[model samples]
Target: MSSTVVETRRVFEVKNLDVYYGDTRALRDVTMDILEGQITALIGPSGCGKSTLLRCFNRTNDLIPGAEVKGELNYRGQKLYGKEVNPIVVRRRIGMVFQQPNPFPKSIFDNVAYGLRVNGIRDRLNERVETALKDVGLWDEVKDNLKKLGTSLSGGQKQRLCIARAIALQPDVILMDEPCSALDPISTKRIEDLMNNLKEKYTIVIVTHNMQQASRVADYTAFFNAEALDNGGRVGYLVEVDTTEKMFHDATDERTRDYISGRFG
Candidate 1:
């Protein structure tokens, strides 16, 4: 009998990617592919470069002084870190949501409209804002309160608003850094559900310490760990990247198994 096969396209191809802050190497020899239209989770112990790696996706690392990257990084078969690449353009296509729900102090409608305005999207502003808000499941609650200050909302609502802000730009990839870290269980569940839905529309890369959350939302998972050096310093590197089911249940690397089993991080 003949078998049918399916192919998945890669959105980001990272080869021997290393990130350095001044003289210190924060990440080392990282190599992986971020597949298109799937949620890829970056899970690991603290200071293991999960967040650092996430920032590299959209070149947000450029914002940090002394931050430098080496090795090849490609997005959509194009060089992501090439001299001709514009960090602003990269960010416009690859949006980010920080660990904290950092909504502008502006009104709710203006908050979601912020990116649209900055990008010079003048036509159908209301439609775009409405679509993004509805996509993140935030419109119903804040529809009438569009003029209200975003900071006045509850923590969960604010985070959802931040998410709306990102999606309003219609980005191709969404990089979330511990998006639900500060929220309660109820809020976290809401965000997790939202993530599962969003993956159908945008490629997602999340840096999470919560193994359960990774298993719940991610289709693929990459585990990172800190390797000690002779000089009393450490560098974070990818241990394994695999289907979430395999990574959580049958990871090949002992370190991955250990981290998943709560043995060590």
Candidate 2:
């Protein structure tokens, strides 16, 4: 039997990525490389397609009606949108955590086990769930209450449970879309800590509106902008891409400086 752990290289490399919703183009010629085992944060004002670009990594954009993608999105050297690429398979290898703490309504155990079961990872279910929960720093707290409803847990735990759910699949990269926007400061801090710990094992890409949060968790940062076209459509553009320090402290673009300095967004 093949080992469940698949050895993949460099997580993703995007080139000239353009996304369109019907006749409206949302993203234009965006390109970047995501190294394996690092956090790359996408930050910008609202409507910059920060979330849209994150969805592209795992081909989540394909689900939208009238949505189309142009250009190369390579995952470990394989073209993600290639004729043979299956989105379900892609999603299994690249998990996503959303803005809200969206834990399933089932028991915590079931919530974590759902992915494994669907993917035929059933033999060591309990052991794997334990390891995953521990990886997200939630094992001890919920060890005795594995059978409890996921909703019964606090907001922080629910988000962690979502993280556990994503990691249990052993994905190559995990995509987070503003995972902390809904949490308290304490909970947000915990999730940020979890992201740091998770970096050693999984490539992380987060889309956030909070510039401070981007600095805290992102190793590489991409600053984006949205252009209001005369046609009443918005086009997302990359204003700058650099290390978190350089982008925040040494930004070249006036817009980036303005946004970071609280002067304007």
Candidate 3:
């Protein structure tokens, strides 16, 4: 008898997931399993629900007015959308970094310390901040400017600070929505390296339009595409999910192949 072994353990299990904004369906029946301690990139053109799917992992979509989500989304076998689940608690466990760097106007130290404070972690606050900064490779650059306003830093520095803020909580997973989209090529390379290092400690899910970035950084890649509806609109859905190597070179889905080849976004 032959048997198959699943080596990668799943952190998030999504089944038949659908998201809606008012009456318009944004995502439809998107289902995939995200592995723990690995980088999974969501790649697609704009308006294809890449960000929507990213938000579903931590329930950030709940904060959006008129947004509704259906189907099963489980975090480590726990019902993610259960009535007993607290969005605040969920966010702490699954932190997020946005498209643009959005550090608070507070001091660099305080910005990284913000989540720890909100979680009432007063002990060793400085140590935790320092560790988080070090994890993102920002400690050497900003160690002398700990008291400086976070906003005073350069764009790349601000992004690293935001990453440090998220890492301070020691989150199980980190959701990044185009984190390097607004940075220069050098800064983008730095963040890519940071992502590779972070996967040793945390699972990462990123929404990116850059195919090269996905191919370069992700271990697994999921392709999303929009389908036109009869009502003259569209709904985004998952087209394929596979190892980065296979997805780029041997994708089974034609849609995925076309998208990866730059035939169509």
Candidate 4:
């Protein structure tokens, strides 16, 4: 995996991105800029395709049979899905952490070392694992249990472990899909704080259903809604994307206001 590109600007500038799963459309012509060193949140109701857009950044959605993407998605000014682009290489630069804490059925140390091992990093595996665990605020608790199975940890600890795993890969950006939906309130708050701290070094994009969570940790928020079409599937659209404060306080779209104010999902 490549380290952060040394720059002083946005890492991603998505332009008129459209996604289709065979004959059904998943995302509309969505355009947004994800600034470096900031956390961007995607919030929408269930089945609204918030996760679909997130997957586009790393081209994960393409793995779905018949799924296709249209328009430009630039990363560091380079088109992400360009003909010469390799999805495996793209994923290396942009790592993803899913909703559940899915650590390998190995030792805690090995869990964090998996990425390093795959990338042929061997000189300082212990040090890197320690650094990532410390960053996720789990080092002190599990330092003595490095040899213990990762599955032995509690729910909160497991989630933090997964986060540590993501960071251990040292990707330029981290995409999180409902990272805290399964954890307790305390765990969720800790993860939120971790995200705030991680923004100093990582560009974070999170897909969350919790509006309050978006308001709390995101600097920018994109609100999405889906309209069920005559065909059987739904089509997702971006209603508004703005600074979190502005979107939450003074949204120009009536639909955005209604959704944010809890009038409708």
What lDDT score goes with residue 37 in model 1? 87
| Per-model lDDT | 0.92, 0.90, 0.94, 0.90
Error of 3 at 130 (Å): 0.5
Tens digit per residue, CA lDDT, model 2, 51-120? 9899998988899999999998999989999999999999999999999999888999999999999988
Candidate 4 error regions (>4 Å) = 1-8
Please list all clashing residue pairs in model 3, or write none if there are none. Answer: none
**Best-fitting candidate, scored by lDDT:** 3
State, as a TM-score between 0 and 1, how close model 4 is to the true structure: 0.95
The TM-scores of all predictions, comma-separated, are: 0.97, 0.95, 0.97, 0.95
Q: What value of lDDT does candidate 1 attain over all alpha carbons?
A: 0.92
Estimate the Cα RMSD of every predicted model relative to the unseen true structure.
2.4, 4.9, 1.9, 3.7
Indicate the residue-level lDDT of 34 in model 1: 90
Task: For candidate 4, write residues 112-147 as lDDT tens digits.
Answer: 999888878898888999999999999999999999
Ranking by TM-score: 3, 1, 4, 2
Candidate 1 similarity to native, TM-score: 0.97
Lowest lDDT block of 10, candidate 3: 1-10
Comparison by TM-score, 3 against 4, better one: 3
lDDT of 3 by residue, 41-71 (tens): 9998888899999999999999999999999
lDDT of 3: 0.94
